[model samples]
Target: MGPNMLILASAAVLLLCGAANAARILALVPVASRSHHIWNSALTVGLAKKGHQIWALSPDNLEDNIYPNLTQMVIKGTYEKLREDFTMESFVEDSPFTFLKTMWAFGINVCRYESSTQAVKDLLKMPRDFFDLIITEVVFGECMFMFLHHFGGGTRIPVVGITAFGMGPWTDVLTGARTLPSVFAFPILPYVSKMSFTERLQNTLLTGYHWNNMIREYYPEQQKIAEEAYGEPLPPLIDLASNISVILVNNHYVLNGPQAQLPGIIDVGAMQCSPAQRLPKDISSFLNEAKIGAIYFSLGSNLMSELLPKDKLEVIVATFASLGPGIRVLWKFDPKVPIGHLPSNVLLKKWLPQEDVLGHPKTLAFVSHAGLLSTQEAIYHGVPIVAVPFFADQHTNARRLVELGVAVHVDFLTLTKESFKEKILNVTINPRYAENMRKMSNLLRDQPETPLDRAIFWVEFALRQGNDGMKALRSAGFDLAWYQYFLIDVLAAVLIAIVSPLLLIYVTMKTVMNKLRGNSKSKKKKL
Candidate 1:
């Protein structure tokens, strides 16, 4: 073969060899939330497409055979009952602490189902040396780590921690990455990097308090559940947590702040993020009907729009009606409810191909619950947004979007029809929001490789590089307390060391001056 042909032949051989060595991946995602499932699917499905064998354990029966190598085993009737009891009333409050409480409680509920569920019991019964790689979410489900011990016959298997949310302090713990909290916008706490001294102080204190709560309450809670499920002395939750080979976060600086990260932290913020295939004919015709551009609205996969109280739905319907005939609206509504009268410009659907709609040229803006994925889609499409935020990181994402000058935000609990109309007008009519979003879109889409490609490469890197005990993985901060890790106590000792000599000299000088004064007084008396 000639030079060029020889190079191509070598490349083809490498690809063949790589596929032949494909590893069996065990992805444990035990959540019922569709939004979370969507994010995790990006990683697991992407891996299956690369010809690796994947076994995904989830609570939902999501059927797809596009990647024949991927098998999803659904644990039916485990956590859905718990989710059924969940309502907007549980998520209506707009505080991060309240969101944290809901998340923790939900996590505890998941643990209860998993520990007693037969599917998980069966999974635990599998042979110890079953899979080469294990992937899971890093949130409250620590008991799942018992698989790490049970699988591989007490040998270590690489674990990857992924979340739909961005990398935060909790994920940072698994890796050795540390970012200056003051230099990064912490969306969860409502503080950006550029803040006043007092704001920074409050931010620092709140973050510390948040970490303390996680360690004190959340960590202990997960540890106990794992012990009960494993029915033995489970490894310390932190130790298992430290072995995470990689952390996949669906975050980009365009939507959230650009925080510092370590090599082990892969920033595939838009993994599995792409415009959808051609919209179904009905969905297309609705967008085509708009003389002016249309607004795409979704509460995302987690929050069902139909769950809103009828009064609130009426307010939303009225707000859409007020928009002129020129402006069209695509609302992701529940088919179960009767939306009394729909305007000619408004179309309701139980489902939407969200990314495709956002990518359409006629899409003027997006009305969203400020889901991270939705926000990411809007950014990728260069479309501005009007956010009706309800709970969780959605509030933070909305606030950041507003700060980015790419969105108009309204609190869901206090939303008024008038206020909603005003925001829609502001974002759709004003040129600034669109301009800012487009600028962010350019940056977000300008990645060297597609987010999926980047995600796959990193995962494969972990599988190969981490095969031997994940030696390249950094665990420096695993055993260190905050004071020791930050060297706060060391700094204090250094300050004392420098100040001590100065303090001693001052004391000596004061004593000499006092003695001299006494001597002068005695001389004056004798004369």
Candidate 2:
């Protein structure tokens, strides 16, 4: 009845009404990988379910009916180049940097190919098209920036950066460009937090190589492709990249080792993670039959296990045979691989539901390639692993798992049957690996809301924030020079201050000593 109460009630009503409004979002996920598709689709689908209109450009074949209020536009290209597993194997012979260069070149190929497509060209050319927020998956996806500016109408639009793996060089540079440390940001490399002098030098050089050569040089090419595709003028790629308000990484600091991160780099790590579902009766029966527990082995769907060398494959099969009846090996074997003479304890299947296997109580360990999604699932299930990482970020992922005390690593090149068997036995027999994994799982699962919920909340929050965006969240250091961000000038000032005082004291002391000597000489003459 009172004026004060009535005013407060009106304010509450306004806030409630604002919260209830839905905004249209355009999510561009223009990559071709099953894992990447799954991650992107889940986020967009979740947003649509929250009553927001979503127009998604993706590589997956999920229909609009599968998701409410989602407009699916698929980008068709010969993405099959990714599966030339034999070529990837040859990359192992090259140095890390060279291998990465080859991969980046391939990514640019994908970008150019995708840009030429009719769907992307048409989507950008749509008349007076606009959206409240632009969500894009970024890695080698710099071209997506044009969507923000072309449709932004000469104003800022909030953009969300999503990556299937953790932050790459560009995202690191984009989010915390100025403050990202050169010595310890081993985003996709294998290194502990504490660096030796030599390691620090390598890390710094590696960081510079990725930042300067790979990111800066390679990013603009995508923009050029976008400009040609749009057949219209567009803003500078650098300015557009800087405008990104938030980066939703598919990683958690708990799983990935501790590293400095900007506030805008939100970790919605396992947003696509699902609870273990029921396995088929046969698979369940096989797992339960294992007296000493079963291990799930899969290198993920992108690469086939059959590509493995015959000698190396023989060694692995022999190792499995050595495990005997006590422990069982459920290998996700490609039937085409022709793995001969499997032991009585080993069961090979062309396809197996991985999450269900890991979640089962009888499953003791996972032999994995250390992909981001698979690692999240293992941690979520509280199962330790023997990581046999081959290429890409897998090596770093494995190293991180080792750092977390939940995994033992085996180098694929030098791996003998003896070494593989030892690692598997070591992880399973040791209580420490499983214990550390459970401790991490508690931290991972103990969050306020699920990863999916957090992702949805932040996305909608960005939509509501509008043009003002989270300008404060982005570091002002981006505007500053590298030396200024590093405080080199400040350090210089401090050094001068310290040296100036000491120099003054030394000069004064020397003057006083000379004067005392002169006084002593005069007194001697008088005597």
TM-scores for all candidates? 0.91, 0.85
- In model 1, the clashing pairs are 128-152, 251-269
Candidate 1, superposed: residue stretches over 4 Å from native: 1-19, 88-90, 152-155, 517-527
Candidate 1 local lDDT, 1-527, one digit each (tens): 79767655654454455588788888888866776777788888777656688888788655544554677777778545665656744486646666667777778777777767787888887777778888877775666767766774124567777776777777866665655567654456655668778777766766676677777888788888888888888777777777786788877877776676776777888775787668889888888878887988888887878778778888988998899888899989876678788788888888877888888888998999887888888888889999987776677788788988999888776878999999999999999999999899899989899988888887787777665646566657656777887899999999999999999999999999999999999999999
| TM-score leader | 1
The weakest ten consecutive residues by lDDT in model 1 span: 9-18
* Candidate 2 TM-score to native: 0.85
What lDDT does the true structure give each of the candidates? 0.77, 0.77
Alpha-carbon runs more than 4 Å astray in model 2? 1-20, 63-65, 84-86, 153-156, 178-183, 493-527
Query: How far off is residue 277 in model 1, in Å?
Result: 1.5
